[model samples]
Target: MSRQHLASALILLAISVALLGALQLALVLPGSDVPAVLALFTIAACVYAAAGIFAWWRRPTNAMGMLITLGGFALLIAGLGNATVAPLEIVGAVFSTAIFAVIVHLLLAFPSGRLDSPSAAATVIGGYVVALPLQLPFVFASADSREFAVASTTQRIAGAAIMISAAAILTNRLVRAQPRTRRILLPLYSYGVIAVLAVPATSLVFTTLGVRGGVAMPVIQLIVLTGVPLAFTAGVLSGSFARTGEIIQLSEWLGASDSRRGPLTAALAHTLGDSSVQLAFRLDKSDSYVDEHGTPVKLHSDTRHRGQVAITTNEREIAVIGYDTQLTARDEDVRRAGQVVAIAIDRTRLANELIAAQRDVVASRARLVDAADQERFRIAQNLHDGIQVQLVLLALEAQQLANASDTPRNVSTRATELRKRIDAAAGDLRRLVHDVVPLALLQRGLVAAVEDLVDRMPIPTDLVTEHENPALTSTVENTAYFVIAEALANTVKHSGATSASVRIDSNPERVFLEVKDNGRGGAVAGKRGLGGLADRVDALGGHFSIDSVPANGTRLIVELPCG
Candidate 1:
């Protein structure tokens, strides 16, 4: 228990002792009814005080504890009226009427310990004004042997009026409360209605019979006060059981492995018995909150609504749970439910990330296949447009040279030019074939093929390879070769580079390729031909990245899974 709760317990204990001492003094006084009335009041005060302590210990945040404790303390103050000493009687007479006001306040604020509505607050204020302040005149009049009849009559009328108004407000609240709240408060409301009616009924009975200080008065008051404490305890227990059941049901519903946010939100709403409950997840990357569908959500509060509670895990906020204003009284319950759902929210978020990664992989593979088909088409067109036309022209020139027999020397010179043309056509065909699939790559190995490519480049290029080159699958070798070729081509054409280097390293599990250049570099992975290269690497289940800054130079890295 906290120091606050311990202090409250001690205060209640002191009040109990004071009430007992006063009741003992009353029992010794010379009166036939003194002992019975004092005993009845003592029993009622003890019950209320004990109930209040229980509530305080169980739920310190609730105001119901303070209200109940105040009600019991007020009873103790009223008990001082039964003391044998003259000074005690005067002091008790001044404050005894205030007990009725405390009772009215307790009834209006049952369970929540708050006067939630304007009408309820007004009723409580009126009860205090009539019971405590207005009754002062009657207290002085009775003590001085002055005209007290009118004052006494006026106090009774005002007290009855306040009790009737409180009953009406409580009845309305009970009728309008949410179904779940109404169920938990039904017992307290029922007892409150009886207590309210008892006050007026006791007054009417005594006035009709013209009787005072009768045995029936204390008996009736005992029954009424006894019901108040019992009703409060019943309400507290019922609410506890209801919350436990809700938590259990929520756990069972969430047990199934569901990764979707919609079902989780629905289950939480149903368990909380609030249809308006909303769930928002925080996107850590974006520093914003989003709904289940990925749309951003804004949290706002107005007079009729409260703000949201941030649900956290490991001190990092992952989600927010929003509820209605009516449900604010049960904030403790809402927080408990939020803690339970935080874990599930984390799991669902991870599952969503995995699904998104899988979709990107599928899309990247499709693009890679499409790019390969396009490259093949371009190769076919290049052969038809460049090398095929040159070969046809070379054949025609040869035929013309053979047909011209009159000018033998001219024929020999023309034939010599035709021989040079044939040599150029053959070289063009060889380069095209190398571009498609290097013969050295298939026969000698990847390193030899890359060396051949470096020799053909227009600018200075270096080739570095690990001595132990583990044989990779054909697909991996082809992809790596093309990736290097594309990077070097981009460097020579776009990066105004003076020199470049290609490095290849391989182990049992993967092959690593790096291309670096001392060039004015601003390479972007998603632009130019690099995007296609990235897709091809992804298709081979590899990783590709580029680091390029203007005036600094560029570095392209590719890792292909060779195992």
Candidate 2:
């Protein structure tokens, strides 16, 4: 049990024992009927005190909650004793008053009000110190009428003063704290009011029956009988208090929510009360967040902008932005959904950043590749312009020298070797230029350029197209031509294919190209040369797929977006 609760239980146990003993002694010892009535009041008091103690044992965090319950029990016992057949005499009343004093001390012992604030602590302790001593006058009241009046007034003042001040302390405690406790403790307030009134009602009913003593005893018995089972039931279900606490939290968040504008704002504007909620996060660290009032403040300087549900994550504060259109305080399931909004927002931000970065990197790399291709084309042009022309001129000069000279075998042999060298160097230069950039592709466009490639191949090849397209941008033509060229090269080098067909087709949305070879088809896109070509097509935001079976010929299909 918690310290506060344990103290309450101890106080209740003492009171129960003293009251039960006084009832037996007062009844058996032949005292006046008033003593017996007071004893009955003591029994009623014990019953209610026991109920409060049991509730405290079940939920210890609610010190004020238990104290409120205990106070109600004390009143039930005292009132019922006064109205019952077994009323307490002077001695029994004194014992009961001492017991009541202990209960008061237990209430004061609670670290309520502002435990951290010395002034709050002093005010709570001072109230108890002033009120506790007044129990003495009520216990020691003489039977004489004037002395009795003084005692009654003192008792009334003491009871009123302690109860009122404790209530004030508890109210302050709740207000300064967060809102969760209020929600959790709401049911307690309801049950307490009902239970407190039950005893007085019971006393009234018994009083109408013309009982010898005051109506206090039987009334208290009824309260105990009813309240014990109820307290036990509440204890059994007290785990729900945690959930109730969360409901209070949700209400607070709703009151403070601000989603005046965003991409979601327009769609959500009319969607605000009966649709599935979708939450998104923005890295929104403006000077201040806008509120319903349209005014702004430095968000860093104001706690209100800290969001309805703010938490520090990785040492950075983030707010959960809620977005469910149907979300409300009355929804029970939402109460347990802890910090989900914050998590959702963080995930969205991370996903968006990743997507943007991927796009940027792909674009950058494509630009670099284009620049490198242009540089190679320039170098190839230079070789074809400068070195190949010069070599051809030299070959012509050597042939002329052979024709003019009479040095028989030597001149003829020199001319033959010169012609061979020139031919070989020219062939090498032409292949180098083609590898750098297909000049036919640059000049003629995709269909004619690919047809030129097929005509040049040693093996028989068919160029097929449903609809011929005009010259595309240099980049698209280059990428498409090379993909077909590489597939054919692979067929020639390794596929041992007898025949190959290249197909080209296009419409408004995209351009489609396919190459199929009647080879021993085991061409894997990654394992074969298709991998590099596939990467090129993908860089253009297109699709590239290779379908090949072990014995079946391979088909390569590619699509490029038409803009």
The model with the greatest lDDT is 1
- Tens digits of per-residue lDDT, candidate 2, 1-563, equal 33455677667765765565465545443544555444445455555555555544433333433553554344443443343254444333434433343333333333220133454456455544443455456656566768778866766665556556555655665566556655544444334334433444566777788665554665464544345335433532354442333333343443443563233222222222213332333334532332222222223323332222333356554333343322333233331332433443344455554555566676676676577668877888888899878887887877777677575888788887887788788788777877667777777677777888899888899987974574455566677888888988888887888888998888866789988888888888774478877887788777999887767888989997654
lDDT of the candidates, in the order given:
0.73, 0.55
- lDDT of model 1 at residue 304? 64
Candidate 1 per-residue C-alpha lDDT over 413-441 given as tens digits, one digit per residue, 9 for 90 to 100? 77768767786777777677777767788
The TM-score leader among the candidates is 1
Residue 461 in candidate 2, Cα distance off native in Å: 3.6
Q: What TM-score does each of the candidates earn? A: 0.44, 0.42
Candidate 1 global CA lDDT score:
0.73
